[model samples]
Target chain A: MDASKIKQGIHKSKGGLIRSFVTIENGAIKDIDVSGDFFLFPEEAFFKIIKELKGIPAKRGKIQEIIEKTYEKENIQSPGTEPCDFTESIMKALEDT
Target chain B: MNRWRFIDFGLVDIRDMMAMDEAILKGDEGNTFFFWTPKKSIILGYFQKAEVELNLANCKEYTITRRISGGGIAFSDDLGRQINYGVVGTIDNDLFPLDIIGSYKQICGVLIDTLIHYGLNAAFRPINDVVVTPYLNTGTKGARKISGNAQTRWEGKLLQNGTLLLDFDIEEMLRISNIPREKFLDKKIASIREGLTWLDRELGEQRDMEEVKGIMKRKFEERFNVRLKTGKLSEKETALTNSLLPKYYSPEWVFR
Candidate 1:
């Protein structure tokens, strides 16, 4: 039976640095939190997008697609950070804790 | 050429200053540029986890607040005397276009010109920073940081506020803040001072804040091709700021 695990990752965005901690359970994202020194436009949209990540398949492509959908729905402009960076940060967590 | 409303808010609480930024960004009152400074405080970036970035133990004596803008944390001290300016303008405007880095370059160019007016060699580092190269700078490191900027957009407007250090006290800063070691390690500098600078340190003399403000006003007028007509907050802005004040001091906002 797949159990829950927490993982963390960091990425240096063009604008600054961003970090993520994700909780995965049963091959799906149980919860995730993100923080960074990077700039992102429409701060509210960023929150809304991240919230949608819950229950998402704990996979790179799925995470990126969900973030992309949210970005397209809103007029997002993250100068140094791209939507994909969030996925990369989540997936980059090489170790389980 | 355009006319921009300008206000001089000499000194204010950090929470109030941040509230004012949001009030201005959320309003449709055209563009505004305000000169203001905070009393002793620790200002965190929007995305920062305060516990991780700030030394709460040492920060007990300091008031803490967070900015809507995304960037690193900044420490404010009234005695340290920094030239803090806030520019709020419409995103569609040519001066601060929708593009992020481009807008940073264009806006920071005005700041660079201001430093040049005082015979200092200043340059804008990408993302958001206005730096003045130390007179005796050497090696791969060309300049020391004198200013740091952070920006945010609300609706169709943008707010770019930054601080230019008139004087810096690294020891005092380290006491209240926990700057990541990597910041110093990445630069290959012995002490942080080698990578940081201030007006007093560079000029070896004190320049009246008024004189600096006057020069800054001129630079803005020349670079943005706009006249900064002195003004006060609109009734709408005042009320909005008042409404937003309490939230700034709330634990949720400050800790989040």
Candidate 2:
């Protein structure tokens, strides 16, 4: 039985740090946990953002699009962070194979 | 003219301090600022993983607590050396602008002005820190961090909390924090020493805590153009704090 395993990556943003741990199985995201020293309004939206990314194919642009869309849809105000920062973190994690 | 409640809770336990901040932010208050020096402890940000960010063995030597706000981990003590403050207020355009970045800048600006008025040349470092750039032989480009801040918003109220390192033990800070990875411990510690500073390190001596508080209070009042009445927590707030204490002490909350 094949199961997802965790891969982690950390990125230093302009003012803080972004750490992402992702579980991937069969080339799709199984689970993800994003934690850091950064501030994000609608703080609860963070967990939801991670959940939304689950089951999505591990493609850079697609994952980036979802991150940007979820933040906008949830009205998350993450100071000193742009969507690219998160995308870069996810991309790094996916490459951790 | 906005009225603010100023409470000076000296030598508090970290858990109780966190609970008090939660309660005040929940209450129907205009704005409140709490000043306190906590017993030696390491406070982890809300979203941080204690296992990843803290040196648990070192934490056992003191105390470990987690805050509702999200930011980096911090070391705080009650020896009248460091001053910790928590501000609770609504998200308003006039004072705490509706935008997050603006609010941080506004609050950091107040803190920078306050530190300068207190006879230290302080400046606001982007996102969430207050720092001082000292004249040195090596000529580091950026300033050294003297203060760190974090915030959490519940409903419409925002709880912005931070620490002012007056007289800190950099050695102890490095010992307890998960900084200076094993491979580069020596180099990292040296770099950290260069990048961070304390008030006493800049001023050359430990100053009176009360005098420091007075300066901070007066500066806050002046910057915000608000008068703060010295006060204590309301009965309801006290009760809420007591109830919330257990949550802060729980393993689930701390580890989460």
- When just chain B is superposed on the true chain B, each candidate scores a TM-score of 0.94, 0.90
CA lDDT for candidate 2: 0.79
Give the residue spans of candidate 2 off by over 4 A: A1-4, B77-80, B135-140, B180-190
Alpha-carbon TM-score of each model against the true structure: 0.89, 0.90
Interface DockQ per candidate: 0.53, 0.44
Question: Which segments of model 1 are wrong by more than 4 Å?
Answer: A1-6, A92-97, B134-140, B181-193
Candidate models: Cα lDDT each: 0.81, 0.79
> Which of the numbered candidates is closest to the native, going by highest TM-score?
2
lDDT of 1 by residue, B1-256 (tens): 6899999998888899899889988877788888987788888998887876777988888899999988988898658578889898887748888778888887788778988888888888877988787566653366788888999877777789898888877788877765655455545677666888888888899998888888888888888899999998889999999999998998899997
iRMSD values, candidates in order: 1.6, 3.4
